[model samples]
Target: MATTFIWPFIILQCVTVVVIVLFLRMFLHRQLEIGMGRIKRMDKENLEKEVELNDRLEKLNEEYDMKIQNAEKQADSLINMAKETAKKMRDSERVKAKEEAKRIIASALQEKEKVLSEATRMVNSKAVDFSILILERVFSEDELSGLRHRVTKEVTGVLFGSDNVGELIRKNKDIEVVTADKLTAPDRKYILKMIEKQAKGKVNVKFVVDKSILGGLILKIGGSMIDGGIAYRVNKAVLELREEI
Candidate 1:
């Protein structure tokens, strides 16, 4: 009975030990599983945080790209604006230059006209003065008066240019004559009456005192002013100069 009781006690003790070991192993295994589950949860949470961070970084990069694109557009716009402004400036300068050139040309033309007019005036004055100098030198003192009167009459006639005042004496017409004062009154009247008979017209006389002819009378014939004086002969030399000019 003691052996049997001892053996059963020993067996009971071994069984108890086996049961305790099994329970311990189960607890340890359960603890290990719980630890692995915690590790997995932590890993998931860490992964989620990493994904969020990556998303945030991507968003920042997109924002940066948008800013860069906007900056580029602004830079291009500025460049275009500068080019347009430069072009406008250049155009304005060209227009101004053209206007200046036109003004200069106009001024030159006006100056040229002014100089031409002055030259013409000077030449005309020279011609008139030159004529007077030649006339003064060629005439004698005594012949000068009679020649001047005859010349004056011719000048007046040319101005009037009446067709009736023709140089030729015709019948039944009024006659005009230029003569010296030295002609005697009765003799002149007789000569006039004779000329009237020949002319078939009334005679009117104009008198001039002239010694330049030395002694000669001038007769006005039809359409002709006859120069019968020495002074006129000298003046003919000067008149021939008209052909040379």
Candidate 2:
């Protein structure tokens, strides 16, 4: 009877162990299903987030590329502008330099002309003075006197032929005669007689001797003067020479 009771107890314990094992297996299967669903959901969310991140990255890269292109274009435009500005400045400076050079050349030419004119004037003046001195030293008194007589005769003829002779004599009662040397008594008498004949009236006569006449005669009547001298001729020649040069 004891053996039969031990066998039944042993069978009951085995049945209890089997029921607990089945319940534990069912619980473990439900938990496994929940864990699988959570894992699938997390995987799907991670894939979406990765796709979004990729899209954002692509957009950011495009924007960066566009910005880089714009920056390069701006840099190129600025470089071109700077180059153009420099070219303009260089051209302007060149023009200014050329203008300044032209002005300097013009000023220098003017100064050169002024200096040449002054030198020419001085040279002509000295040449005339030297020629006068040489002529004065070479000609004797008698030779100079003959030359004076001839010039005086010509001047007298011209004066006598003029229509204003009577008016000149009437306007000025005093007649002044200039000569390179003192006239001889005969020449003086002849000149005075000629003057008195033309005047048709008596007049006071004044005679002046100036050796600078260079063997010619000069006549002064009131404010009018007749210059028939070698010096006057030389000065006129010099003026003509200056014009030619």
Candidate 3:
């Protein structure tokens, strides 16, 4: 009977222990499920934040690249513009220099022409004067005395020239003859005959002696004079030539 009572008590203890174990297992399983859900939610949030950071970094890199490309393009444009401007300036300066040189050459040529013209004029004038002086020296002083006969002949020839003969014939005035030497009768007669021939009629002549004539003869009619003297002819020619020049 004691054995039988002890067995019943042991059975009852075993049942209580089993019930406690089962309750404890159920509580631990619920706690594990709650912990797993919290872990999964935290991992999801971390992944989303990493994606956002990566996208922002990519956008910033793109912006930087675009700005760098624009800067390079602007630099190239500036370099080309500078080169064009320099070329234009150089071309303009070269043209201006060429024009200036042409102007200088033209001015020099004009001045040279003016100087040459003046020099030629002066030379021509001097040459004419020198010729007159040489002629004057040929019949100067005693030389003139010896040339009187030739001078008288030349004068008669001039009086009988085509134009002069007609002019003297038209005048029909009395002529006065002055000479440095006394006229011999034959010389006077010959001179009167020459005058009458050129005048185309008999012309009255009055003669006078004047040593101031140096040599040869002077014929005066009204306001006109014909000097048959080397010195006088040379002087008159000089005066007329100078006036013409």
Among these predictions, the greatest lDDT belongs to 2
Candidate 3 local lDDT, 64-149, one digit each (tens): 89889899889999999999999999999999999999999999999999998787566655655565466468767556555666
Candidate 2 stretches with Cα past 4 Å from truth are 1-3, 6-11, 121-236, 239-245
lDDT of 1: 0.63
Expressed as tens digits, the lDDT of each residue in 1-245 for candidate 2 is 99999999999999999998998889988899999999999999999999999999999999999999999999999999999999999999999999999999999999999999899878888878977767668887777668667876776677656767657876777888887778889878887887787778788888898877754566677887777666666777777876898
Error of 2 at 222 (Å): 26
TM-score of 3: 0.42
Model 1 clash pairs are 143-212, 167-222, 168-222, 172-200
lDDT of 2: 0.81
Cα lDDT of all candidates, in order? Answer: 0.63, 0.81, 0.73
The C-alpha TM-scores of every prediction are: 0.46, 0.51, 0.42
- Model 1: which ten-residue window has the lowest total lDDT? 158-167
Candidate 1 runs further than 4 Å off: 1-20, 124-245
Task: Tell me the tens digit of each residue's lDDT in model 1 across 158-244.
Answer: 422434433355522433444434666764565466556555556554556565443344556444555554345444544455446
Better of 1 and 3 by TM-score: 1
